[model samples]
Target: MKPFSGTSLTDHALTTGEVLLTYWKVKAEYQWDAGLAMSTYLNGLKQGKLLGIHCPQCRRTLIPPRVFCELCFRPLDQWVELANIGKINTYSVSYVNWDATRRQTPEVPAVIEIDGASPGMGILHLMGEVGDTLEAITRRLKVGTPVQAVWKPDSEREGAITDIRYFRPIG
Candidate 1:
């Protein structure tokens, strides 16, 4: 209680016990709608398929389907099916897990440009079955390397992004 000297406020202000602190735990629950575009896209994943929206004007097929074309500013009504196979656009090897914990086996995340979609149209997914070590994975995988989605078993799919467990290099 040495007046919390380093704080931005004047030392005397805190030393006098003028500041009040409190903590509260609140619980709230809510439902989220994925909207028309995303709902369809996620459902397709549950069925072991990839879905996208096509902009007739711009002629770009977009994954993680949007309701409207960003470039053309028009409603996207036409839905197109995309191939699970794609080429790795770029990738990174992570030594840290999502929770900031050190991982013995590094995670490989990559942007993959799906086949049959417009150029540069891709999805973010993890790479698996590449290799056991960082060096081996880096040496074996590269930009433009062909890959395919590895989906969860049909019974395990829950209509979520994780429906497809990860992408792996195709032989």
Candidate 2:
């Protein structure tokens, strides 16, 4: 791989000087169907709740609801309502946006293991209510820090994971 020059796009010139490249403005839309297990899980989010599938054999309650247990090699049994509160298992802070653009405020993303789910079984979500400075937020977002889901109003929900905007520190 070629070593990066660490220069901005506008600073780098094309190999052939005076050659103008035409850029295309494109727009597209895409869709994906999350069958059975995921569908039910998203529905629960729409209703301002959390749902998990229980594996009778291992008794593991899985979040984001799995249809089968990879460990037990059997179908997951009934759906169980899980506690909205949980603890931060792990996390990361991003200074850039999803498209790679830099932002003034960093985004703190964390994997919170739901209260009633099996150990280390958690969902990746943004950490909210943490103040702007990286140091301050990082200090507060320690592993095992208690948190709770902050749900969007039902009227604003679209049956997606975004239904719960982010998890905030539990008072």
Candidate 3:
């Protein structure tokens, strides 16, 4: 006895018929391999030493070591130890989280070119101990600032990048 009091098919095609819906909640676990060069690199980190791969063909030493030379397409076989000290290549002072959340304490991330690696070869790391105030930090920490890795204690290291807590000013 009751009829639907709604728009017709021509007016609203979707409103007249049933629509099938599906929800996929996948919980897939993945295990990634760091491969040969990175494996050795992580091993070195556990010991508080910085390791890099040497590309003989192009004569470049790469930091955050790689399995092959990106420039020459040659295998990187030689592992060279790098100085924990490096210079700030470039940096930024962030006031918000990556998710756009405002952070109570700003973070200073810098790209540091580790010593013994080719120019412009660097790793992204956080900056610390550059003074408390923005004026002091900006004055002291800038491009070309000499900084050293503040490594966490060996017992606390988990073969992760955080093994180096942050890069602190050398002087």
Candidate 4:
């Protein structure tokens, strides 16, 4: 609707429609590969299971599912079941959903260093029963405190990211 001026022809376009037409010329491309390993991991979540790969070389277990070890730069061939239990390393509460479509209805997000994982290792997830005081860093939630996963109903279960509904405090 307005004329924009700049060095490039696209930037110098006289109309919004023309500018959008020129923008596609420099669009970036990406390729995604969904293989069996990833599918298996998702399926496991739906079944209320937590999985990880163990690096025999370093004796460290990686969670949140990875096919390789970045520390040793080696392919992790051995797989293991990670305890669904973990600890709240760090956490936060979001007033809005990530897509930005939902209004501010408090959601608690946390980074749990799953049990059995090497020290300082953790997975990012949400915490259950957390409210607007998500910024309460001085409270409990110590790094080694126990936690567990909260799963979705079987009927609504999908072998994907929504599998484990969320994580919660464990006694």
Candidate 5:
């Protein structure tokens, strides 16, 4: 038995606040490349295809695609094609513009959980064609409302997030 010098424990307790502050500073810098999955999935987008990853263990398809099986903690090389349509899980009206530079006239942003995806997984994009009378819209926002990405014109295409202008109602 030696002296109980818990340096690791002391260090964690002493620097907890500093650790949290450092995380806050780095959060914006940590950009996840969900878009890169497009290499595998976006071919579908270009040809109007919807792609997802299937986990054999959970037997669930994960949209936006993943390289590893999250449920089984294994690697997934299998790809599955999904429907181009999905549902809006939730949405909000944004009054602020990007970079907070100005007040956005009025826009609806939504979290769409596509069909055939794993539980608790979704994508965020702009919601278009929202009517003036908000009450007329269904507030339920159930798990199966059909939606699709509205792409920008070739002249305006920038090969980035903005390429898909917005996720709008599939009417």
Candidate 6:
């Protein structure tokens, strides 16, 4: 057996100038299936409607429909058509874009509790047509303020969440 003999790298050596490093940016692309539950939900949006799933055991309706109940651990199949109107459960005002760029108009994202779904069951969405200034939007919109979906023209819907352009305060 030959004993190993090599120069051990030290932290100071690596930190100073003893080590060489390389960096690369790789581009990747992919596609995925939305499955039965999500596909139906998205299709419902394209038709200017909100859809949810019902759990018979717990008697609770869930938005962003799931194939199973989290509480009962039961497979869910019953589908319920929900109303486009809902109340804002919570929200956030963002001045930065998704790419971390600053923007003049702030984006308001909120969790809206759909009318037909169980209480406290909500979906995360953006609020639009509210107001331009921070003070105006904050003054007009509240946690429980009612809002309705603003759908794009029927001809433009593409079976995606964006089909509902955004939700705005209902009067």
RMSD of each: 5.6, 4.2, 8.3, 6.4, 9.2, 6.5
lDDT-based ranking: 6, 1, 2, 3, 4, 5
Local accuracy of candidate 2 as per-residue lDDT tens digits, 42-91: 98999998998899888888987988999989877599999999999998
lDDT of 6: 0.93
Between candidates 3 and 6, the one scoring higher on lDDT is 6
Question: What is the C-alpha lDDT profile of model 5 across 32-90, one tens digit per residue?
Answer: 66454667675555555567888888887887787886668987767877665578887
TM-score for all models, in order of appearance: 0.82, 0.84, 0.82, 0.70, 0.62, 0.85
lDDT of 3 at 9: 48
Instruction: Rank by TM-score, highest first.
Output: 6, 2, 1, 3, 4, 5
lDDT over C-alpha atoms for residue 51 of model 6: 98
Q: What's the lDDT for all of these models?
A: 0.91, 0.89, 0.87, 0.73, 0.67, 0.93
Return the clash pairs for model 3, or none.
none
Deviation of model 5 at 7, angstroms: 33
Higher-lDDT candidate among 1 and 6?
A: 6
Please say which candidate is ahead in TM-score: 2 or 4.
Answer: 2
Which tens-of-lDDT digit does each residue in 86-127 have in candidate 1?
999999999987789999888899999999899999899999
Query: Can you tell me which runs of candidate 5 are displaced by over 4 Å?
Result: 1-38, 132-144, 153-161
Residue-wise lDDT of candidate 3 within 1-171, one digit each (tens)? Answer: 898697534434455555444569899999999988888888898899999888899888899899889889877789899999999999878888878998766788999999999999999999998765667778888789899999999889988788999999886
Clashing pairs in 6: none
Clashing pairs in 4: none
Residue 10, model 1: lDDT of: 77
Please tell me which model should have the higher lDDT, number 1 or number 4: 1
Best by TM-score: 6
